[model samples]
Target: MYFTPALLAAVATVIGLATATPVPEPQGIAAGSIELCTGQYLQGRCTTITTPTGTCVEFPRGFHNDVSSVSGLEGWNCNLYHDDHCTSASYYVQGEQDTLPTDNFNSVICTPPP
Candidate 1:
């Protein structure tokens, strides 16, 4: 195929746009009960709980009152639950700091309630 400069530019533009677009962030954890185990000053803490839908929740940095505590830690140990039932759980540290616990740490894959 004979490629023209304009055609190449158009292709490049399309590729750039496709890659640059960011993925939409998941919606924050739904309404559910959280069991958190946090230490004073946000140190030496571990959290484990079950979401209302059996999503298997975990507490990285042990559930921080704010985002700063888990800002640095990533891939800590934690468990998840949904609807008061144990589903899939794993250990993961904090990925980013956010007011919401779910937003602060990267949640491991877990089996949601059937």
Candidate 2:
């Protein structure tokens, strides 16, 4: 069978639509990532943490008790702790936390949303 240009274009459109994936809400931020900032309202020095497989991460030395803002938790749930290894005091956070409940957290464990 001979295929015309219009027919090919139509087929491509259909294929593209069929294979397209729905974009989750709050685009840009990935499913398992969080941003930590030293100032409130997401200002000042900032760093991003990615835990695609749900892992515990410790804040670098001097960063402990210095994170006043947190963001990029669109599809993730993270537990902030006041001690290393995700121990001691903990605060649960999800979504953009422009001003963290507490800025003394020293460790975090981030997991993708269920």
Candidate 3:
């Protein structure tokens, strides 16, 4: 293959742009119970979700650590901005029952676990 300086520069620019892209942050909290949503087994149950606008919402402790997986909640809808920045979001309860308040509210406010 013939290697051209311009082609190489173009490829470099493309790679740079892709790497420079930022991920969306969480914007709101999603409510749900274990019975309601079911699927892959989570390490620590997702007690609550913190949605911080223009930034990634850090999971409490357990649950999916990766933003991509967490964002993939079936009922949960994510409004991602630049990269993975979450502008608006909501969680849909799969099962039925009373809405229990999240226990780790402080975790979301004080120190959001990465």
Candidate 4:
């Protein structure tokens, strides 16, 4: 088969993209962050979020009413709220919480220990 210049360039581009090393995800826990999981006993789908000291952030998308366990608090005081925007019933969490009182918390605000 005869290869045209454009075809060769396109093949090269495709090859580069196919063989290029992908950017790896973070390996472990970073400072000022926590992990939440969907299963009790710290098993199953889990995601990490930056706590940003004393800021309130809602559980994004899938995590809403889905987190059954938590870990990596690292001395941060986390107040888990039952309503969005950190209102209504809330539960306090410090240190690694293998399981929450309930998995229905919709928002959380974590403050680093002084």
Residue 3 error for model 3, in Å? 0.5
Best by TM-score: 4
Q: How high is the CA lDDT of each candidate model?
A: 0.40, 0.80, 0.34, 0.82
lDDT of 3 by residue, 73-98 (tens): 33433332222223333333222223
Poorest 10 consecutive residues by lDDT, candidate 3: 102-111
Candidate 2 achieves a global lDDT of 0.80
lDDT per residue as tens, model 4, 1-114: 899999999999999889968789976532377788999877889898887666777887888899898875677888889988887978988878888878998888888777
Q: TM-scores of all models? A: 0.24, 0.67, 0.22, 0.69
Residue-level lDDT of model 2, residues 1-114, one tens digit each, is 999999999999999989969786775434477788899998998888775545678887667899998875677788888988776878988888888877888888887767
Q: Measure candidate 4: CA RMSD.
A: 10.1
Q: Rank by TM-score, descending?
A: 4, 2, 1, 3
Residue 109 alpha-carbon offset, candidate 2, angstroms: 0.6
Query: Best-fitting candidate, measured by lDDT?
Result: 4
Clash number by candidate, in order = 18, 0, 16, 0
Clashes of 4: 0
As for model 3, its CA RMSD to the true structure in angstroms is 15.9
Q: Which stretches of candidate 4 lie over 4 Å from their true place?
A: 1-31
Query: Model 2 compared with the native: what TM-score?
Result: 0.67
